[model samples]
Target: MRLLRDLTNITFLELDVTSTKSIASAYRTVENQTGGKLHYLVNNSGAGFVMPLLDSDIEMGQHLFDVNVWGVVRVTQTFAPLLVRAKGTIVNNISTASCMGLPYQGMYCGSKAATRLMSETLALEMKPLGVAVVIVITGNIRTRYQGGSYFSSIAERIGVYARGEQGHPQMEANLYATKVVGDVLGGAEGTIWRGAQSTIVKFALAMIPTWLMNQLAVKGTGLDVMEI
Candidate 1:
């Protein structure tokens, strides 16, 4: 956030996505800033973890759902009035995980999948209200999210280096995000598969059977050798 604040032309408003009051406050701020008009609402806040479903702490996992699923709903609903007035677009940053049920990532994927579906429904509803809804079905690139749920070996490797391409860890992911917003402004709609390996994952899920896909997903996440 500090980095964003350092920029010259960007206006930043702080809010807690999990807190409805905070989102409402942010909405008020944005409304005041833009004079009761908004051009875009991007639901980008999310959280995730990796653990066996049997061993997972259901209570703790609720926080993940709150941040990933409820957060998007709260932010969008709170700012919807302004959005409708502007006839704007809503862009959601979803994950390729939403389309695949990989081992040990059920809760995270569930939250994303929920948001993906919710956005689809929202697009339909928002159409009459003159607002566009777009969802970006993203895939892994590189970031500083060192995930938990007892998978430190994998978590520790995150953001250590950019596996492919010649730039910083978040370069491609950030670029994709920027592109999505511009595309929306240019009349893009529905679900967009972006980021590294997103298209491959989407196409594979389309052609592959569920059982084989599950087996491959488990192997891809290193669950084949992972101890229970």
Candidate 2:
């Protein structure tokens, strides 16, 4: 937040991801401010919620898709002209959840999976235009965007228990928090600008078959059938 405030020429536009008009207006504002020239577009806005696939509310799922999938598309499409002109780079802030499926976070993972495919396709498409496209697959970060108090309220309302286990829910939440903190400390700067090794690992895992990937995910997360 302070970064935005500190930047002199940077303009912050508040727009709803679900609305095309909002997206268009934001673009117009940028163009007006910068005289139709732009550089370095970073798509970092997204939303997610932690809930089981079955019990996940339809509205929450839709909200996640709106912000995570359509939002990136909207922003990218709107700002692409500027990027093309500048021959600049587009950095999409993706997530590790795009590859590894976690328990009770199905909605978030599904949205990110969509984003991953979109990013991949866009990278190929934009290659011809001399505009570089980079998808930053991040692990986690200590941010309030993870629905802080809202998650607790939702858990309380839903009566948190997955197949007669109470501690599992608490453990899942704690693990998520711990990982987020670790990632922040480990230098995730809203993008994967460093640590190229992790990026290679993610790409390798993504190339694996679905069945094998699922097995690896389950095993890696320690979420065997007996545990879940």
Candidate 3:
């Protein structure tokens, strides 16, 4: 936020994507500010949890979906009219976890996966109206997200058996952030893989046979100890 404050043209608004009232207020503010046309909307609000399925509560899972999946939906739905008016672009930031079931990140993975599919459908829906939707399939980025997910602080403990082969290259998101804006400005749409080795990781997961992938998953996450 301090970074955004440094910019003269940036208008900062506190928006809670999970709250309809907050979204509505933000919509009214942006609509009035932009004269009822918004060109770019990025659904990037995210929440993370680091726990095994056994340790996860239903409420915890619901909260994850609320922030990660439903948050995007709510934001998009509210801002879509403005987007259509401007024939704008919508960028939805997702994660590599969308495609894989990572150890100790059950609901996080599930929420991202849901976001991925929802973004795809949104793209199709927006295209006819000249509103582009881009789904950013991001990998690991070193930032508050790590802190948010407790990936380093908490997941490190619960994930002890889950870190077999390693995942993500642990990156600075600025590299992809700027690239994505450039790509969107250049008319890129659909899915753009970003973050360190994001494409390679997704490809590897896709190409690996199910059995071998299972072996890797189990051995990597140390779940192989339960092999019968």
Judging by TM-score against the true structure, name the best candidate: 3
Predicted structure 2, TM vs. truth: 0.68
The best candidate by lDDT is 3
When 1 and 3 are scored with TM-score, the better candidate is 3
Comparing 2 with 3 on TM-score, the higher-scoring candidate is 3
**lDDT (Cα atoms) of all candidates against the true structure:** 0.78, 0.67, 0.82
Query: lDDT by residue for model 2 over 1-228, one digit each (tens)?
Result: 564698887666788777889888888888887778676676778886766577678998998898999889988898899788877677777777777676677988899999989888998898789777767776534344444333443454233322223332222434544544455445333334222234554675768887776675555232352321
Clash totals, every prediction: 0, 0, 3
What's each prediction's TM-score? Answer: 0.85, 0.68, 0.88
| Number of clashing residue pairs, candidate 3 | 3
Candidate 1 residue lDDT tens string, 134-176: 8898876566563345555553332222122223234264687
* Candidate 3: residue 194 lDDT (0-100): 83
Local error of candidate 1 at residue 143 (angstroms): 1.2
Model 2: runs farther than 4 Å from truth? 147-228
